[model samples]
Target chain A: SQQGEEDPQALSIQEGENATMNCSYKTSINNLQWYRQNSGRGLVHLILIRSNEREKHSGRLRVTLDTSKKSSSLLITASRAADTASYFCATGSYNQGGKLIFGQGTELSVKP
Target chain B: GAGVSQSPSNKVTEKGKDVELRCDPISGHTALYWYRQSLGQGLEFLIYFQGNSAPDKSGLPSDRFSAERTGGSVSTLTIQRTQQEDSAVYLCASNLEINTGELFFGEGSRLTVL
Candidate 1:
């Protein structure tokens, strides 16, 4: 079963602009993770936010989690054309025997 | 291996036939996972293995879908009597331990059933 649902199935933005994607999940989770996937390739782990933490950053990636609302968002600042890919949110629940449930993903296109 | 590896990057088979997809996780990683991705969709968790024992098999769509991990390093997913609906990219991922936030994924095996 899927635990997360990402909004805005597809997004297109000009290079150097910012891109933001939102994810809403059901049930409590130990952590939430974001991933990037190029066309027809494997997924690359981007950043993870623990349940106790509210916000985290890595390079141009920023993640904010609001456990109170069971929602999280990913922000990519100064997005580059190379950043064009699909982004996904995965949630971890110990009750599920350590399996990660993923969202449908948001397809992002960065145009120069 | 340097990263999680999946073989038969592309496979074409006829309906009613069986197919085997293989995955080799990073060395010493004790956890392995199998997921399916339909075109324009997110990954669907199929199964998880912890040191050759699958504690959670609820994700398996049907009895036709089965997986096994051997030596705690490599795993195989077998689909018996494959159907066209099974045509999708089968992905494998691994992590150092259970409940880890990050997972290492493979390039995935694209399967097409005709």
Candidate 2:
């Protein structure tokens, strides 16, 4: 079963703008992670926020996790044309034995 | 190797035939995963392996699907009697351990069943 669902299935923005995507899950998680995939190929890890962390940042990527709401959001500041890709949120729980259930993902297109 | 590696990046096979996809994870990584992605679709978890423990096979969609990880390093996903519905990109990923952090993914194998 899918544990996470991302909102705004698709988003288009101009370069230099900011893009925000949200994800909600069904159960408690050990951690939530964000990944970027370009051209439907390999996925690159972006950031990971543990259940105890409310927010975390790496470069221009900011991720926030709200365990109470069973939700999380990813914010990409100063979006670039190169940042155009699909972002996925994955939830990892101890009961899952290390398997991370991913969301449907948000496709972000940045126009130059 | 420096990263997770998958072989036969692309495979075109006839329906009812069996196909096997391979994955070689980053050296020493104890956790590996298999996921399937259809065109424009999110990943669907297939299976997971952790160390020498019995793999978690709950995510596998059907009896036709099975996987095995040998020596806690390499894995192979086998789809028996493939159907058109099996056509998708099979992705392999590995992590250091359970809940340790991010996963390293391979380029993935694209399978086309006709």
Candidate 3:
């Protein structure tokens, strides 16, 4: 079963614009992490936000987690063509015992 | 290796045949995971190995799918009597330990079942 569900299955924006993607999950999570996949092959870890923390930022990426809503959002400021890829949100829960359940993912395209 | 490594980047086999895929995680990492991703689909959890403890095989779809991690360093995923539905990219990832955060993934092995 899928724990996380990402909104806006696909997004397209011009370079330099801000792109936002949202993910909602069920059950209590110990932490939530975002990953980027290019060419549908290897995935790179982007950022991780623990349940105790509300927001975290790394470079142009900003992540916010709202446990009350069971949702998380990823905001990419100053998007670039290189950022075009599939963004996935994975939730790690104690009940799962260290396993991370991934979402359907949001395909983002940054037009140059 | 500096990162996770998977063998036979691509594989093609006929239906009812068996295939094996291998994964070598980064040195010193104690946790390894296998996931399946269909074309244009999200990753589906397959199996997980943590140190020398028994693996969590709950995510495996059926008895035909099995994975083994040798010496807690290298892992192999074997599928018996493959079907067309089994065609997808098999991704291998490894982390430091339980809830340690961040998983380093390999380039993935693309499987095609004819």
Candidate 4:
């Protein structure tokens, strides 16, 4: 079973526009991490936010976690055409084997 | 000196044939994982191995799928009597330990069952 579900299965916007994707999980987690996957390629780690943290930033990427709501969001500021790809949120639970459970993912397209 | 690595970047096998996929984790990484991704779909957890501890095989879709890790380093996923529906990209990832949630993924092996 999938632990997380991402909203807006697909999104399209201009290169300079900001892209936002939301994810909701079904269980308590030690942390939530986001990954990016180019077509036909392996996933790349983007950001991780621990349960105690409310917000985190890496380069142009911003992530927020609302443990009370059991949801998280990733914001890519000033997006580029190269940023077009599939974004997934993986939930890691301490009680589990630390194996990540992934969401369906959001496909973002940035038009030049 | 490098990231996780998988063999046979692409594979084409006929239905009913058995196939094996391999993964080489980064040196000293004790945790290895296998996942499957269909076209335009998120990854599905397949199995997990942590050092010498019992492998967590609960995520495996069926008994036809089995995996083994040797010396807590390299791992292999074997699918017997493959079916056309088995076509998907098999991904391998490694993490330091159970506490570190971050995973480093390798270029997956794209398997197409004919």
Give model 3's DockQ, 2 decimals. 0.80
- The RMSD of every model to the true structure, in order and in angstroms, is 0.7, 1.0, 0.8, 0.9
The lDDT per prediction is 0.95, 0.92, 0.94, 0.93
lDDT of 3 by residue, B61-93 (tens): 999999988898999999999999999999999
Candidate topping DockQ: 1
| lDDT tens per residue, model 2, B1-114 | 899999889999999999999999999999899999999988999888887564688878899998988888889999999999999999999988867989999999999999
Full candidate order by lDDT, most accurate first = 1, 3, 4, 2
> What C-alpha lDDT does candidate 2 achieve relative to the native structure?
0.92
**Regarding DockQ, does 1 or 4 come out ahead?**
1
What CA RMSD would candidate 3 show? 0.8
DockQ of each: 0.91, 0.81, 0.80, 0.82
Question: What is the per-residue lDDT of model 4 for residues A15-69, given as tens digits with 9 covering 90 to 100?
Answer: 9999999999999999999999999899999999999999999999999999999
- The superposed Cα distance between candidate 1 and the true structure at residue A101, in angstroms, equals 0.3
The deviation in Å at residue B6 for candidate 4 is 0.4
Q: Rank the candidates by TM-score, best first.
A: 1, 3, 4, 2
Q: What is the docking quality class of candidate 4?
A: high
**Model 2 ranges off by over 4 Å:** none
For residues A1-112, could you state the per-residue lDDT of candidate 3 as single tens digits? 7999999999999999999999999999999999999985799999999999999999999999999999999999999999999999999988998789999999999999
- Alpha carbon lDDT of residue B88, candidate 2? 96
CAPRI tier of model 3 = high
